[model samples]
Target: MKGKALFLFWTLLIGFIFSTNGTLVYALESPNTDNYQKDSSYFFIQYNGEEKEVIVNGNITLKLTGWADDSKTTVNGNITSVDSSNSTEDITLKVNEELNELPLNETEIINYRIIVADIFKSEIVTTQELTDSSTIVVQNNNGTSIEEVKTVDEYDTVIENKGLIYYSSGQSGEKLVITKEKYDSLNIVKDTTTIESNAVSEVKATPTTKSIKEVQPLTRFSKSSTPATTTTVANKVPSITYSTHIQKIGWQEAVRDGALSGTEGEAKRLEAIKISLENTPYSGGLTYTTHVQKYGWMSNVPAGSISGTTGEGKRVEAIQIKLTGEMATHYDVYYRVHAQTFGWLGWAKNGESSGTSGLAKRLEAIEIVLVKKGEQAPGSSERRYITPTSVVYTTHVQTYGWLQPVKDGAMSGTSGQAKRLEAIKINLENLPYSGGITYSTHVQSYGWINEVSNGQVSGTSGQAKRLEAIKINLTGDIAKYYDVYYRVHSQTFGWLGWAKNGMKAGTEGLGKRLEAIEIKLVLKGQSVSVSATQAFKEPLKVFLDPGHGGNDPGAVAGGYQEANINLAVANKAKALLVAQGYKVYMSRSDDTYVSLLDRSQKANDLKADLFISIHVNSTGSGTTSANGIESYFYEYNPDYPSKINEDMHNNSDRIKKSVTLTNLIQDNMIQYTGANDRGTDGSAFSVIREAAMPATLIELGFINNTNERQKLVTSSYQQKLAKAISDGVVEYFRIY
Candidate 1:
């Protein structure tokens, strides 16, 4: 137990030492033998691209780099020195920046126990009988006879003789011997053997043999009761070889027959690829194309040529592969890719697209295989390459302010409240291409503001300026594949005609405010059913009556007639409402006297939404001190003893709505004109009481007061009154 423990300890120590110095070793034990003898058997192997010989029991230091595994199947290093003495000296080597594992080919191995450097790894075996050959013998320190095996054909052979000896060595300089029975039991056949180091090449002589048969190199060994059987064929089997150029890493070593060539789980993009056919008897080759980033699908290229961009930092988003000529008839090429967001996608065959197209995703890894015609596929062949596109938007409204964003043809602002959209922001979602959505807005005071892109604000926020018109468009690949359509709900127009791809969407010079907007991103050549002509809503009809016009001159003071001042203010208010996209009607446009009952009848017949009678406050004598603005809405008073119409009596709903309108107009008139606030009250005026809709009477500053009448008669003060009344009407509709 102590001896075993000590052996284990020393073995571990030596392994640690070698590993620290970047050396890998695989050790196999040979059978024990008592007889010690010096043997002249040697191994012939390729060293530094040259064939060399190494004798048994010879010690050498080998310098190698890029060591991969215990088997050393893939190596990019070579032997730098050779020695015959049993000296314990450290060997040094240079390492490659990126070490890769590669498959082996022919011509890598020829005989037993030989280490080949800078070449693929393989082993050869043969089945033959030894006869009529010279035998060489040697004597060890004990003077015992050591029989030497003779060289046969270049291939390894299986002998039928008994009592044959096989020899091997270990680190402690111990010899291992294999008896004939053990050799036969091993059932050694033609198999692959990899040279692990740039060590001394040890070649054992092949015994003389007759009736020798050839076999292919072995890639892996498996246990069997008998030797592996092989049948001769007339043609070589066809195979596919491929390599990938990856991000950060350059082109990797090639792999064959459906082996993986690119990295998985590394987040590296496959930028380019080279694919070719090997060992094929057909006359034609393969062709492929790639969908690249920024530059869509590239042109087709022949096999072994690059089908995508390299060194430009572009990603391969998709690929299509197919065969040509006789090869196409004999086989079908199938492939799948590991995409950026989708992971391993379904297989694609015969030139169908394999990865995503417009999604702007990258290909990370890939696997390819060829099947004979009508053979079962490796996986499902359903193509999956779709990306959804949409537009999102938000609006700052007159009173509601910035509402939450809406998406894809949904309304972003208020609809029927007559609120103006003050500001806007827009963005595109899942737009699987380059560039972004850009938009420009025509504002009330600032026309055609510079364009803003992708969720940026395009209209005024806190300034209370309305977005009168807008233009939307896309850039780069987004423009190439998609069209942006938008329509607006203006104050009077309701919904205007649909505009597309940078066309004007709302009224520009007419000064109409956009109330609501709907935006959509449609694929090119697809039809979306949006209103292409004005889908007019019933406009908010307002009836404005200039009180006591024409035949009856209203209260006159300081040479200013109340009738003329009322007419001027009403006309100005009509013009302002018209610009705001409202439908305004006046009982007297040019001071033609209309009775109070006739005025209310005209407004009711028109089915107006609101009614306001413009007038001036008065005291019969010019000496009165009464001054300021006031408004009145009607409510029924049973004690008044005057017979009232049914629409005017006990109509609580109309009274409440009229009161709201009266207060709004009264407050705005005082605010704009800086007049004394006489506030609002309920009255039984004939025009307001008999009106069917919400009705109010607004009184300008007192006409009998010299100071107030002086200001009211001026054109500037009249214009201010018009603006105040129009704004109050707008505010009323915004709330109710």
Candidate 2:
């Protein structure tokens, strides 16, 4: 598989979404996939007035359209979305001429519900009739009744000689209208008509019955009359009822992230809704993520909305308003729509507000805008609102994500250290703002760059324009040059900044453009790179020193020998590392006595990069309860220079990795062999103090603790103990 010309894909967080040839990437880069912030998503069907109320059942045909983010691919999954703003209505005229049935008034509707049994909740997506909110009919005792319906956009019906017994398949308050001409078999002998109204009717009888019976089909838009009519299916949980109204219309809140919509909590049960909605994602059909930040949840907020009863929907029994200017270092607001008014709402920070009681004296909406990477939109660090506009109007719009498309080419540097500066120039040829991947050289850990199209030599090129930065002290290993990514959009679609390295999958074309820039180098001979990766070729070697020896026991614990344990465990690990081609040497292979000086001599003789020593554990309490494993490195003590040198090894973060590995091993071993995790220790022991390379020593279990001592005496325990130590070594390196 080596020479197959494999493509190196590095698509990262949010921005492109293109799915082609059945190769779809389910996970699109969203702004906050990590923090769970998402872009827009959801498929929608544009409805005509006659098709508003659709009752879903068997034989339903469906086709829909949706949106995707800036990615070229996305994974397939259930679609989650709010109900569409527009709705359609379906009315049917079913009549038995012999029965002489009467028609319904224009403003009125008659309902005949049929409770179908054994309907599976999942099959609704495949069933055709179930997809349409309008078309619905229920089988009744005598004949089929009106099933379901919705108002096309907004409808105001004119009721005639009314006989309205509204029917609903499953939706709440939705209904379909029936006509008298359809049911002409029944006669109106009473002076007053049933469900009478001033609208058109299908019945040929003069208005007589004055009783107006109202039955809003469980799903129709408009006031409904009370009735005990209902349809219950077997073995199915009630389908969650949802509405297109602004208030809490569904069983759950839609957007549950602070930065995206400000509503916070566990990721909404989006997968459930997506399954219900025919695999369409809800948030405006966006495939990529938007951004991320630490967040809280609407875990306490129920999915339903309050009645705008003014004050005290602050749910719970108390109201606490906190207004402090001290916001957490990382805090973002989430958003959602209120069911009562269908308005947006969001989560707030613990300590951020207006005017001070000591803080700003007001509550504010949270809005943020960031231009996506690989895009030409001018990236805004944060959002700024027009102060003059009404504030409460946009409290927490559950409707949209704060996404701004790329506008133009941001600049880079002066083509200093880039491997192929020539490609940078070619990349800018047809770009709206010609700024040939302009970039300067960077020698420091921290750096900056300007927008390429805004390629000014000063402010836009250096540390001042570092659009994004990470905290890794990198010394340029795999990448030879930094290629900035640009986007294609309307007026401002062009260059942005250094291709956030590997931002999207199969980005060879972008890399090819980056390889085209030609730079003028005045080198007298060959190019001299400051990052000299070519300087060293020797393999890193490490000498393992299992502290103490035969004649001299390091630390007397219980009745066990620490020196014997150290050498035995170290030898087992030596075999493992050497098997993987790592050169290793041990201070003393046998139980024969050896001095600390001699151990360092062997390590220094081999020019090792690391030295590790093993030992046994014990406790001063001398109590049976006192037990556990402990790892020791050098202790940082300002009083001694050796202390500082060993502290250097302990503080390098490598030891922490060692400690974690040790703890895991000891914990597992303790569980299996009845030993205990005494935890790890980083201290300055003599072996740690004088090692030439980074070093550490580990203590197995306490022999002083009688229980552990007895356990240590068995060959089975010893072998398990040896395996644990070896495991810790391998984990510490994250290599073997």
Candidate 3:
């Protein structure tokens, strides 16, 4: 008994040393090994664009720099005499001398360490397997990439066109220069409003006296109002004036408001265009589209905006625009484009534009659109209410089929009720909107239910089932101009992933219970004022602790190490959680020792929503009979401060949460691993008791059990266990 106690003490002492120092101190007996022989390996030194190949027998010295960009420290020398800025440094490469004598199927690596200087004092160690002509990049000891950082400046746009002329305001009826040549012909005006005793002040024109008729025939756009005198009231008509910069013509005459200005039949391209609007008060507002050289049609832009590329070198071919929404019915939109030789052909209304199809003619200059309020639709013979611009929807919920329909942007499903949705429908009232609705739902027990289109039923009406999630998108013509963004409020992981366009947005696997949803639609660059009220909730942020690592290998038996198994399973679980978009973190990603306090502290610091410590069970020698999987959790105490929830008092919420998690994991362990059921139990384990959030410690089964130990180490069994744990976590979130 005394000898056994002494042996245990020594084992613990070795473990402590291994933990403090960066090394492994094994207490187990060494396995038998065969003699090995020296082996030759090849490698290439690579830096920037330079490369050198060589064979290494035992050790080789490399000339290196502090950083790849610092060429001042370059020097070559053998191991001990490295030409570093600091004192002499040493590098050593170690390999099994008799590797050739080992079995051919065995794998081995050569280990090397370098005492680096220059940036700081440090040692770098790494292992490399013997390979033929492998490229080795010499880098800093701190593992930072030695490449120089590149900085990019923000982009700025500059405009410089000789076609744009500047003018000044003078007296009413005074002639205004409209062309560059005409402006240059005058005593070039330097300052229009500035005046001083000795300064040569230039006269400017005001609205009443300004006569903008000095422009030549090519630059003069309007034939309507010609050099209006103060005597005659100026005729001001609502209009849109535009000018296009052609490939060769530079800038042609600016088109009169509401008139076509550019050539149409020529095979030239319109390089750039500028538009200006006046006197229209349509609520829908004005926007235009442009077809560029390579990129087809670009999105619409507001009036007085620039379209088509200038210095970018692209040309505008075809174009379209519209007065959207209320303005769509109020005004008729018109536009026309310039072509190579055909000057100002016929005008196109609405979204139409006149331009050559396959002809390579450039659109030199272009005139802008003119919006004219159309006469009210001839009074209908029979009285009818105005049509709505959007569609409304409603869902027939479980136990309550066929609810009243709601308006656009309103909630069609129930929230905080836990009630399931059975069927749903939408209405456009047969009013043409150039599109139809297509939607899919995730229902209880059924992953993603069949998709429904228009006003068709998405889920079964008679079935007493719950609706988990839903996705909605537009189809047909209107879809080309609109986008939808939808989100769901679920029982677990509330307010799950947001789905845009036609992508699935809510939880699918593990059957999360969806409580409410909010759907919205908007035109590009515009805000949707839709609002749907529902109970809001936060998402789960879980932290996984892979217990025991590095020197502190837990419960080793049957040639299996507990720490290794724990890390493997925890990593797998984390991956599964991440794939589902759950925020997750692991206590240890490598074989490194971590204190129990530190593990719990990490969860507290991260304010993790859930904390789970993964470990393996083991009995003393000759006690392998203790098998099966179990989960342990700390009893909730109000006196303890909750890091995840500040409002959490001595309430039973933590206890309930922990127990749910424990039972879920334990049940899944048994179901997936087919191990004996040990059930969930309460405990004050350090990892659980100190955790501020709902926490659980799971013992995945005894490594000492002969049969279970064999199954525990297998990759397939680990993956199954991982999947089960992930499923349990999802279930816990779903319910709580």
Candidate 4:
């Protein structure tokens, strides 16, 4: 055939063979006329000079003749049935009387190397009328000759070697061989074409070229061939390659198959990932998603595309990977991650979630492999998916009122503003177990208040009271799984150290106020850097003097020794001050002689921050009507009562500070005891005048008054006075 004519013929034939809409149509001759049909269930094979249709579960017979070494041989095979239920869904031909199942589209040697069938979904044949003049004779290697008739238009590229003829179908590089019957069915007027001798031998000697698609030899046998050579299918093993966008390092070099794609034991994180298949035998690509830090699970992306974030510093926490289309049928994609805190987790396969979710963990390293269908997995698949709990809290601040809630170790109150935290509410979110968080607080005017649980207010709100200290604890099953950690910013002290599991987080005895707070929930067994004990502010030093102790009882009325009353009140006040985180020193802890000069000298030598000398007032014997509280500070008057030294003149700042301290103490005493206010005064008294720090002298009441004396000697009245004094000291420090 002429090259141009053959090319034109093939162009028209190829166009007619494949449909534009994807459905295949075959033009079959019914021994008389050419007709077309859309049949995918049947295929036709030429045997001798007859066209036979092979159907599923049907029977057929063929006498396959081939030549080797210049000799001719024939083999009879009866195909009893065809089964399509195998793993690959290829048709299995039950050939010969042995009922040997031979898969189609594969090379097999049945006494001779022959391709049983290269079945297409559709078949077609083009014919032309021919005369005896068009016939040609081809000679074989054995000097044997056969008359080949010009049947149909000659194929554009036909290789006739030995007895077999090879031709291209011109559709997707498919190869086909023309039998004598398939040509005879074209209604040629001349002699029929026939196979030459040594057909199989010539095919075996000829090496496959790029013009033809290579056919894999069949590995299965008919129980007759040499235990069947295993024909390894090319590119059968999937090539899975992946890259990770790591922390610090960007996208790393891609790794293939089951190689590690991230880090191991380095504590680095995988922030993003790109997975792809190279030279894979499947039709579709891979799809994957990642559980990312802050963002959670991201949407799935196709193969070779990024699944998480990059340049955001967020970690890929968990992952889900899957194969699509024919790839999913033949292989399973299995992956595992070395997570932050968790190390290497169990293998997850085919879209199952791997690594930890909800927990703020990073995927440190990852390994991925493609396993053939029904194969053993790489490792155990026992892992946890954690939904971390959140601790939410709110605080009520002085003047500003209750603030909005915050969660997960966030600060909930103001700082550096001198505003006090007055109340608090706390709760747990997404807790994976039963029970809750409970807390209590110490407030002004009230000691440790009642405990509150799970969002209930812990301290006084709306009342101008300050929260001094707090204790937080977890309860029930929640406590079993986690620990609660908390800390506070307090007045005078700044930020205190962390306290956990019901330990106090703020100041105790010191009248300091809580300014801000932070709370956190940690998983059990996880390490948290906590202080050995709650931090505290350096305590202020206070010097207390019980006036006229031992034999020096300055006032006595109603069987009450003034020295005994002063000692009792001073002791109670010291206890209260010490509890508030104050360092208190008394001139006399018990009944002992302490002169005014000795008291002032002791306070100065100790370098006390504040000095207060306790005394009882009297207007000589019958002053029963005079009763009240008065406080005195020192003011050096050179011309009035006594000579003022240079050191006394240099104490102007001390004198002003002393006046403020005296007024605070006197006002609190009057409020607590309901004593008449005798007001504050300045006097050149030795106790106040000679002290280095701020100093004050408090006259509790007229000791000669019968009613006041009765109250001063009692333990309850002394405690009231002590509380008032301690409160006044707290107010003084808060202002300073």
Greater TM-score among 1 and 2 belongs to 1
Whole-model lDDT, model 3: 0.55
Candidate 3 lDDT over 1-736, as tens digits, reads: 4433543454454342221123222231111111111121111111221222111111222323323222212223222222342333332221111111111112222222121111221121111211111011111121211111111001101111112233433466333334434443453435433322111111111224322223121111222334434343234345666766554344445575656555555544576565544543433455677776555677666554446754343557667766665456756666555454344445566676545443333455555555546643222212111122365677877666777777646676677677656666654443323677789887777767778887888776676776766778888755664567667667645665456667665555545655555565555444433333222222458899999998999888977799999999999999998887678988889999999878878888888989999998898674477788889988555555445334432246776788889888888888987888988888757778777778889988889998888888988888988888899898997786
Error of 2 at 725 (Å): 3.0
RMSD of each: 25.8, 27.8, 27.8, 30.8
**Residue-level lDDT tens digits of model 4 in 1-736:** 2433433443454333333223332221111111211111112221221123322221212222221221111123333333363222222232111111233323211111221221222122232221111111232221222332211111111121122332223356443445555544433315533432211110011122212222222111111223222343353566898888776455577798789989888777787887778666546667898997657677777765567864344578889999987779889999988887667777889999888776667888889999989889887877634468899999999888999999988898998899999999999988656899999998888988999999999998778999998989999988887899988998877888988898887776668899999999988776577773545444679999888878887788776788888888999999999887889999998888987778878887887899888888888887579889998988776654432224652377877788888888888999999999999998878777767788888998888988888788779988988888899899988877
| Candidate 1 segments exceeding 4 Å error | 1-235, 294-296, 384-724, 727-736
Better of 3 and 4 by lDDT: 4
Best-performing candidate as measured by TM-score: 4
lDDT of 2 by residue, 1-736 (tens): 2111110111232222322211122221111111211121111111111112222211121211211221201111112212352332222321110101111222211121111111111110011111112222222333324322321101011111122343322244333344544433332223223421211111111123322222222221122243222231122221112111110111122332123321223211111110010111111111111110111111121112111111000111111111111111212221122111111223212222211121101111122222212433222212111111000100000112111222223222222222221111112222211123333221122233332322223122222211121111101311222233322111111222222222221111111111111112111222223221111112346577776787787656555677776676677667766664457788888777877667766776687766777676666545456666666656555554552244344455655544555455556556655554556566656676666555666666776777767776566676776666555555555542
Q: Give the better candidate number (1 or 3) by lDDT.
A: 1
lDDT of 1 by residue, 410-487 (tens): 999988898999989999887556789999998998888999999999988778899888889999887887889998
> In model 4, which runs have C-alpha deviations exceeding 4 angstroms?
1-235, 265-267, 279-283, 292-296, 309-314, 356-361, 384-386, 389-483, 486-499, 505-544, 551-565, 568-590, 593-612, 616-661, 667-696, 700-736
lDDT of 2: 0.31
Ranking 1 against 4 by lDDT, winner = 1
Positional deviation of residue 414's Cα in model 1 after best superposition, in angstroms: 22
Sequence-dependent TM-score of model 1: 0.32
Model 3 stretches astray by more than 4 angstroms:
1-252, 255-392, 398-409, 426-435, 445-447, 476-481, 509-513, 522-736
What TM-score fits each model? 0.32, 0.27, 0.33, 0.41
